[model samples]
Target: MAAGGVSPGGPLGAYVPGTSLLHRCPPGPKLLGLLVALTLAIRWPEYVAVPAVALFALARVPPRMALAQLRPLWLFLAVAFGFQVLAAGLGTAIEVVGGILLAVALASLVTLTTRVSAMLDALVVAARPLRRLGIDPDRVALLFALAIRSIPLITEIVRNVREAQCARGAGNNPIALAIPTMIRTLRAADALGEALIARGIDD
Candidate 1:
């Protein structure tokens, strides 16, 4: 998020340079494949493993790096799996959790191999057909870009807030963490909006 001093393969967001098959693949096809795989994973959880493994291998993403990306989601995954187990059964829990992990892993691989600029350009091109429907492809692409960039920014904000809370002995108080994070996030949004307007992207 600092734009420097962060690993390209870090859990946040950055492109990892590689010469693997996935790295060589164009963003358009990679995105299409991701969409198909995600749909299939949702429909048939067992199918998730196949593509997950294949994608990691093709991307030449180290197992450690892939796991690093998932590390942050462990708590959410555990809670989801546990809730599913209590509500349904272990099999159902596995399917649900597996689908979620597969989705994240697949999406992570795409971002890992594809540069953000390249991905945004690909999105603009992909959205071109929607121009007939009164949609602006450039704006649509910009939205996606912002969403992608915001994830890491928000993550960093949360981390900083949590650290400050702990230092202040707030000890994981949800309100303490949430309020400051929300304020900081809003300020960030305001700054981003102003910057856009200054650039004449007010629309």
Candidate 2:
């Protein structure tokens, strides 16, 4: 997503330029730390707050940028939290929602501090062992790169669809939103597939 000078337009996988300790850290360690933190948070959701605060502080990312990472997910999180509250209780809902938020925040921190290329290189190296199982490390890394790139593309598509709907006073219509979003997403996928084929990546 950091390729060229184009911004991802959303905070999800966008790298923010900084010179903090986290930024100086290598992508492999950051990724390992993220996996560990997420595992711990999932196993003990009650303690998610501590790491959430610590990571954000350590990353030194702008407050607005950090918070923006959660903006798109808030609605989905809220709904899931409400379901948890009804199925279990307030404490359970808090733990569930807190863990989810912590996971997102931690992953965002890694991406924000580490460059996309660095992460892909680290992944390729880490996946080398999988070559024994007939898995191509470069292809695995390329797949990850495409997945990361798609997130922002999908986000932008949804945003544009929402804006257009709002302009037509159909902002509250889920059907209107879902239909166009799906259509656009499919078109984008087709274009991407064609591009890949043209580059001899059809296999």
Candidate 3:
């Protein structure tokens, strides 16, 4: 991607700015919506998941773009569905996968609509009550922010690693990709930890 260019159909959690109703909503409400969507998706029938997934897409961007966000997981989802079908039945597989996809979609919506700073602020505020129990809200909020921000970084690392492997004619080798990816991920984590310590934020 070019400087400041939007990545084409990045997986969920990549925020896209928009002028939709969801974008206008506060983070707290959006978080609540995510919770509600997840609850309904998990506790209700499999069919309910379809709408949940759709709503997540429609709220963020066009349906096509939303689907693109999920493209990366298509293989995993397919494998999971296949396993479920073999273990149980087609209907059960559909239900299980649908529910998972729905949850993923709803979560993507939350991150897409809400800015990272706003998310951290909301988390800090929400965690205030826990401060009485000796929990540091700021630390908790930082952890959440790190987790969200790390998703895209990790994705990029994987993409770069795959490309490097492909250049060396190892593109089709899963082991070749996995080994380097794991090593790079660990190095990245170590670097991140070192940076945090340097900034005196490792607490």
Candidate 4:
């Protein structure tokens, strides 16, 4: 509904807002950190060696803000914890949860600090190094914007459709929900394509 906005799960997934030190880091390194954290997260022992002091540092971030960003993934984290505890034990469960959360915390820091426009600029700059692959910088930027913004927008549409369906007591039928959901999704896509063309995305 607004320009320079966010999407729910795609590129705009889990945007955290803040003006912390972590926010000003360059996009390349910030993205690199996410990659490293993800690798460490899959191994619980990695969580323990992360240095208590660093964990404490992350703790300094506003809990309410972090919690809000983490909310979307809470169910998945809980499920992973449950699985680890059942399949492994309390120790493993704690390890998995800590590792995953550590990654989340770092990512949250990046998002909270960086504005969407800044992120787009960074991505465009980073992709400049990829022009050797016949990629257009403008197109790449548009792609990033669309992918990221689509997340929040799609989530919004889905939420609206779901609520309307449930209000009519049709929430139980998967087919009913899927049909309308798909239709709405297609409509959104068409609208986006038209908007992009209008903005000269194809030319």
Q: Who wins the TM-score comparison?
A: 2
- Model 3 poorest ten-residue lDDT run: 1-10
Worst 10 residues of 1 by lDDT: 1-10
Per-residue alpha-carbon lDDT of candidate 4 for residues 120-169, written as tens digits (9 for 90 to 100): 79789878867899988878877776786787678878788888899999
Write one digit per residue (lDDT tens) for candidate 3, span 1-203: 11332234443236677878888888998888778778877788465666765666567576776676688999999999999999999998988888777777778777777766677687789999998999989889777766666766788989999999999999989999999999989998998889789999855
lDDT of each: 0.83, 0.84, 0.78, 0.71
Model 1 vs truth, CA RMSD: 5.7
lDDT of 1 by residue, 1-203 (tens): 22443323554365778899888899999989889888887787686788589778877887887888799999999999999999999998988888888889888888888876788788788889999999999889778766666777778999999999999999479999999999999998998889789989975
Off by over 4 Å in 4: 1-17, 36-60, 73-83, 144-203
Error of 2 at 53 (Å): 0.7
- Against the true structure, what is each candidate's TM-score? 0.61, 0.62, 0.58, 0.60
Q: For model 2, what is the alpha-carbon lDDT of residue 12? A: 28
| Candidate 2 lDDT by residue in tens digits, 170-202 | 998999999999999999999989988999996
On TM-score, the stronger of 2 and 4 is 2
Candidate closer to the true structure by lDDT (higher is better), 2 or 4? 2
Question: Model 2: residues >4 Å from true position, as ranges?
Answer: 1-13, 133-203
List of clashing residue pairs for candidate 1:
none
Model 2 residue pairs with clashes: none
In model 1, which runs have C-alpha deviations exceeding 4 angstroms? Answer: 1-12, 127-203
Evaluate residue 137 in candidate 1 and report its C-alpha lDDT on the 0 to 100 scale: 91
